[model samples]
Target: MLRNGQILFLCALALLTLGVLMVTSAGMQIDQASAEQPILVDGGLSPIAIMSGRTGMYAALAIGVMGAMAFVPQRLVERAIKPRPGRFYLMLGVGAAALLGLLLLVYLPGIAREKNFSSRWIEIPAPVFGTLSIQPSEIVKWSMLGLLAWCAVSAGDRLRLFWRGLVPMLIVLGLVCAVIMKEDLGTAVLIGAVGVIVLLAAGAKVWHIGVLAPAATPKPVVDRLNAAINKLLALPDVKTKLDRIGVVPMPETPAEFNKRIQE
Candidate 1:
């Protein structure tokens, strides 16, 4: 019988294979303006050429990475990551600071790049790869998780104390979320949700979790929200449901939504 890890590995491999096939067939469709640029491919420049080549390379690299991580012994992995005797807080502070600094680079001109109107990747030039970009938000997601785990482990017996254990961890988590929220609000929310799960697993008080309620959406963000009636009216499939409800949809800010819910 295939082990659980082996089954997961096979599933991942199948998904990656499907991705490679899609890239190979669909190819990227860049605009004529960008196509004129020479950065895409070294000798030959075309949509299919660039995507097929890069995607193939990335798939190979990903498979190798997965293999390496899967084979590492659990005990050695724990020892490498586990906090040292005296430097738990120091390690968390330094590591989070370094990651935050890296994440901030996504805003720098020439170094930062955008995709789908989101500025969240840093560009790097490599001899073999030509041009490569790294998503600092992806790193921030996992690093925040690691920081939460470290906080939980370090807190240990003092986890019940409000000031001694919980407050400090909450501050760090908030800081990480705030930084990530600048470029990727969706991802920051996901990180916060996962952090809550980690905290609860670590035996944090339920009331303490309740204290971290979701904040109201910003005014600028509220202004950007489309009217609910417009959206509902546009959906042909739900028109009957809306008619039967006999309720009118109106534009409302997030604060208004909260107020109505409370009422």
Candidate 2:
């Protein structure tokens, strides 16, 4: 039987596999077209060549991330935040400062243009490395988790009082939400959900958990709606099953109807 941690790991692995498969499927046509083309170009290969290189780079990043996570000692993480009262406050302050720095970096002159109206990533120019990109929201999510966990553990006896324990958490959560909303609403929702989960695990009240639970589900629908709206806004041909909606002389097969619609 797998332990709880092992089960969670397997589930994450499965999800990662599914995501990669989806990406591959989406790129399949382009990948095939590229593969059929000549190998060399003036300075570099075609756009397909660049994409093939990126695919390998992405795979390497995934492997490196997993390897780092697997080898890193849990004790080192724990020690970094060392269960001390003042240190927790210090860490929270540091996290806040780092978040602020990211925000400023995203808005700065040259960097702001690179963001394309979405201030979620920072492009750093490096001499030898060309350019490096960082996502501030990802850092903020992890930081919020650690900070909330610290708050929960510290609140201990004080957790009995709703005001003392809950207030601090709410304040931190609001700050994080505000920052993330400026850049990416989707990331904000995800960070908020994770923060709430960490709070619940830290022994937050049942009512609090109930209040936060519903916030997680609607965002997925909102995201889908936004994507649809964007597609429509772009003035692309709107293709939908609705075009065939009950408009057959004799009832046509579903597959046949779909093929006909495409035609």
Candidate 3:
């Protein structure tokens, strides 16, 4: 059996491969200006390439970033939320400050680069990567997610408290969202939604945000819903019989396994 971590890694690698393929394929174009030129002359780039072109650079960068993350020191991550006695809890502030500073970079003089009618990127002239346009909002969105997880873990018993745990998280979440919302409303809302989910997972009560139980459905509406469900179950589709006990035999796996075992 594959370990959970290995399974997750395999799934992520597959997704990354698919994304690179799609992105590179999107760059395909025809020479409409030339009558002699063929359509999609070179076909397209492969799923993985190393700094061959724009898409190649993106693929390489993606692999490099993922590899860097995968190889991060376990102790460094542990020390972020847990430290020995008498040691300073510096990672929390450093992390928050770093994220905040990155967010603020979008407004910096000569560094700010605008896209989609908003100043959300900072263009840095990288050596091999040409002009590397860094979107601070994107960085902040991903980085702060891990930051939120660390905060939630470190909070422990305090994570359940309104003022000490949830409030602080909400404040940080609000601040990040408020910043990103100015540049990109969609990303801000996404960050807010995911942040709220993390907080909730960390044991923040739904009532902490003033949520109440939904009112009971009307009897007529409930009856209609039940009827619809029953009708769905009565359909001729294979999934329809899920309401009743049924076996779905997937024989391919067993066949392959048996063949391998015999071989």
Candidate 4:
């Protein structure tokens, strides 16, 4: 029997694979800059011009990490809820802090890479990738759940308290969202939603989570789009028409929807 977590991983991997294949199959074209220069075509694959190589490399890296995590022991994962002796700067104790530091580096002039008016990536030159761009927010997003879990478990019964238990986690969530929002509002909203949900499941008070609720964070255009699509798919006629065309209706969470958009 597949566990819920396993099912979720499978779904995510399926989406990633679909994106990789779609990108790899994109038709290649001649180098437009060199189009005026002499060109030779020897029946080689010319249509893979886009970001096929780079996309595949990153996709493979993601899949590899996921595969590794799958085999990790559950006890080890649970043990990670608490930090190790004397070394309090690891995943459990300071994971969020470490990620926060890395994220702040995005504002450090020369190293920061900007695109579309956002400074969310740090560019590092690498062998095959030419210039490898690392988004610290992506790392933080993946680690936040475990960090929140640690926070909740650490808080224990204190979680029932208003200021003591949840506020610290809320601060972490706020800092991350605020930093990411300066560049990527969509992701900031997504992280906020996930953080609140995780804390709620961990026994946080409804009103406690609601403390940060007033924020629409300027706007999360992707989540809004996803919600609208779901409302449309809820209608019987829309569902029937899609079925006739062999279009299966799959509602994605904000995270997954954001990924599809990024791809």
Q: When superposed on Cα atoms, how far off is each prediction in RMSD?
A: 9.6, 14.5, 14.8, 12.0
Model 2 ranges with Cα > 4 A deviation: 1-52, 65-78, 114-116, 126-130, 160-163, 206-263
User: What is the number of backbone collisions in each predicted candidate, taken in the order shown?
Assistant: 0, 0, 0, 4
lDDT of each: 0.70, 0.58, 0.66, 0.69
lDDT of 2 by residue, 98-213 (tens): 66566666667765544466767777776644566778677777777777777667666554455656666666677877777776765565566567667766777644432221
Candidate 1, position 133, lDDT? 82
For candidate 3, write residues 1-263 as lDDT tens digits. 99886688778878876776777677677657568866665654543342366656766677788778778898887765573322213445667678888899999999898877889889988788788888888888888888887777777767677776677677777788778878776677567667777877878875564211224756566556555544533445424333133322222332343354346
For TM-score, candidate 3 versus 4, the one ahead is: 3
Ranking by TM-score: 1, 3, 4, 2
Residue pairs in candidate 2 whose N, alpha carbon or C atoms collide under 3 angstroms: none
| Cα error, candidate 4, residue 67 (Å) | 5.5
In the range 1-263, model 4's lDDT, one tens digit per residue, is 99998899999989997887676555334444475673434233333532257777788789889989989999998785553433322433366678689889888888898887888889888887789889888988877777877767666667778666667678778887788878876666566767777888889866454322233643476557667757856667656645554545566666664465446
Specify the poorest-scoring 10-residue window by lDDT in model 2: 240-249
True-vs-predicted CA distance for residue 224, candidate 3, Å: 39
Q: Per-residue lDDT for 151 in model 1?
A: 64
Indicate the residue-level lDDT of 37 in model 2: 77
Which parts of model 1 have CA positions greater than 4 angstroms off?
22-52, 70-74, 83-85, 114-118, 210-263
Query: Could you tell me the lDDT of residue 64 within candidate 3?
Result: 80
